[model samples]
Target: MYVAVKGGEKAIDAAHAWLAERRRGAKEVPELSIAQIREQMTLAVNRVMAEGSLFDPDLAALAIKQARGDLIEAVFLIRAYRTTLPRFGYTLLVETAKMDCIRRISATFKDAPGGQVLGPTFDYTHRLLDFKLAAEGSLPDAPKAEPHIGPVPHITEFLNKEDLIQQEPANDKEPRDLTREPLDLPADRALRLQSLTRGDEGFVLGMAYSTQRGYGRNHAFVGELRIGTCAVEMEIPELGFAIEIGEVELTECETVNQFTGSKTEPPQFTRGYGLVFGQTERKAISMALVDRALRWKELGEENVGAPAQDEEFVLYHADNIQATGFLEHIKLPHYVDFQSELELVRKMRAEAMGTMQEAAE
Candidate 1:
């Protein structure tokens, strides 16, 4: 409403220069290369790709470098860049059972097929930080095995054979693609899963934790958690055949939660599902818990008014790019608004003093 700030371009340029210098830290210290980030900081790159919903590790690494190691900012960059890409045909749904699992385990069963391969996990390692790695950023390579080529079986099939778990009827209906359309309320299970797949890892983790803390108790057991590479296929209309185009790393989780019989339904165990873009077991497990909580209505359970139970709340706030943008907007100048508040306070003080003087007289 007021005159535009005159020298903003110059000020912005100067501020940006300062920021660049700060980001680099020191000229003498060697700069971080994209390769170093891609290889050494693999987890960060994976997280960015997971949240960004883009599978290009190289592009993600570049974005991470440009964003100065801010994962949320890197995600934003990747999202913006992704929108410009031309729409292509969709890929086929990945087959988890056929996954060449690098790591697979089942908590509910002791003798799961593939025999609980503890492939590359930090679960058993001590928390102590070895400062020796600071000087020499390398270690003696651990033993590696030729991966099992045959299909590793799922633990759920065993329970399904017994008819102890609730049967999930196959629904071939096309799921709503949230990426192409604006999000709508009363989202379906697929839509909710889409939101969670690209949602903030920490936010999803915290919401899942709330369930364990009695906010919305769903006694969850890790029925199966697997991390592996799976083939990505697309059906070529001209060829009339689905052919493998590439492969992607994925972390898939299935949780068996408690179930109570309703008046109309028989008692059986319920399920929660999670599938993330990479080896992110914690995120995947957490995603399953929150995913189950949001299904209160579908499960015929009463609304406990828990945060995770609110689908609208979870889906809306799950996006990190939106969250960071709106939150960071407050840092912008609010000169006019501040001036109005300052004038009002000054006037109120003056009037108060005048009234007190009159009363004294």
Candidate 2:
């Protein structure tokens, strides 16, 4: 006999309690502090911040812990928490040229004004797992250098002087916030870039890789990649001046792509840009390439029917939160729908059998 199951509330409560116990681990074990997570799991926190569109490491760390070390779930927690936060004001446009950089490099130039500082990177590291880190210990202190001698000017500014790249208008127009607004079709650069910054790293990487594998392959050179903290300033109407509310670490990437000129325009180099919260260079670089591929139409280049060129494809599938929610929602009750489909198929087959017998007779 089939009996309908009840006590869903009890079942849910039990599951939640089990989850809490699991997250905390045994009472004998030391409690995992938020500070410890923030310090030790910095890379995971960075990804959460980058995707969540928030910069608070501590909060991200807490979210990560609460989500049981699920990075995407941590990002979801941050995004949900961020919605309740009141917007005191918006930051003034951050001047990256004035960024106090920890790492800055350019592939287009041999030597730029800001001498390439290969600050903290894993580019040269061996992939072997460090067993030494299993035991708590400290390494020897490296020699420290004096503060940088002078201000580092942007390499792009040099190209801008000669007008080698397309000149962008410095309009003081206010841009729309992607979080508040529903994304519409034919998005402008501001919206596209904003969506991409919070996009899933793997998704962006795959789309960028597709472009490199001859799917709208526009020869791209990294114009600049920078990682550093920048002051977030907001203009107070009451004070009639901008104030430094806070600061956030950011990764910015700009790409110079080779583009064929159209009938109306002469041959010239074009640009693609990526900017994100925290030190996420890979995500930023991938975003820049994908951004360039999406701009084929605006640049008057031939549409190569690339996945990157498809704005709908890229923007819609980029966000992990949306993708995950829809993907996992299938776990919810669909028995009724399945039953209906099953009945329909059975009836269709029975009718087909009857029709076949009648035709044969």
Candidate 3:
């Protein structure tokens, strides 16, 4: 009796060992600590948290280290870990107005009620790399300041007073969670925004840039951009009062886009909003513009046939995890399919040769 060869167990173990060794690199070099990764490679951690929908910076850092600095893989790890977490209770809607904002700015007005605070941005920095960063260094501590600033108000409140922009309606209706439900056709604003927030940064940015290059261009202006930590509160059924569960850093962007008066409605400026789970201003701003562009239909605007306007096109290709997984899976074995195709081609060639011989005869 003949027996089939079996090496699956050994193969898997060897592959895992090899992967671990490679991830660790040369034994001579020191391993990267989670804290180091979190502090030094903050942007990568931010991306992972944003996409993974997990706000734990330390866990994100650990995922990055395990992934060997592959941001996408790190994101995947975080996402896998995030799925295992138990859901306690839903948080009460965070009030941004009460947010002790560290940074806030508005492009609509030169000077607004809440004065623009350009806090912690790389915008003004030169593109040139600082060579000093190549070596570990520390800077001297600066002087401390008093902490008694009054609560800052939103600049949009001023515009709302003038009736220039549409006032947002507050609804007590519960919004559907996209993560728990399969994405459906004709998604609402909340679902679309949720998808965009967790989407790949580059993909969203490219879509936004395309809009600027005359594809669904809505003439967006950065109406406001704010980054700060906000308290997440949850109401206890027994207590009958909301309590602060935790705090999460977020970046919120609101874009003011051109709006034309329809036959039924008066002309007024419209807005697109983006809120991300970390300090990701670029992604948030890009998302807001794309969100506005996608709203053309609801606003009674003509279909521009732009990439951003195509809901299916934008939503389907936005997630890097889904895209990369499908792309890389092509590398896996498909010997049976290839063998079938090979046999078909050989049979066709043989048939052609036979026909040619008969014709010659």
Give the number of the best model, judged by lDDT: 1
True lDDT of residue 226, candidate 2:
84
The Cα error of candidate 1 at residue 299, in Å, is: 0.9
| lDDT (10s digit) by residue, model 1, range 86-194 | 8887999988888888888899998887788777788988989988798766778878755555577778878899888888879899998877887888888998998
Rank candidates, lDDT, best first. 1, 2, 3
Q: In candidate 1, which residue ranges exceed 4 Å CA deviation? A: 1-7, 346-361
Model 2: lDDT equals 0.86
lDDT of each residue in 1-361, candidate 2, tens digit only: 2233445888899999999999999899899899999998877899999999888999999999999999999999999999999987677788877777888889999777757878777887998898877776875688643323335677777888887887766767677899888788788888899999999999999999999889995688999998887778899899999888887888899898776678755677778889988788999999999999988777778887889999999999999999999999998877667777888888999999999999999
lDDT of 2 at 107: 95
Among all windows of 10 consecutive residues in model 1, the one with the lowest summed lDDT is: 1-10
Q: How many residue pairs collide in each prediction?
A: 0, 0, 0
Inter-residue clash pairs, candidate 1 = none
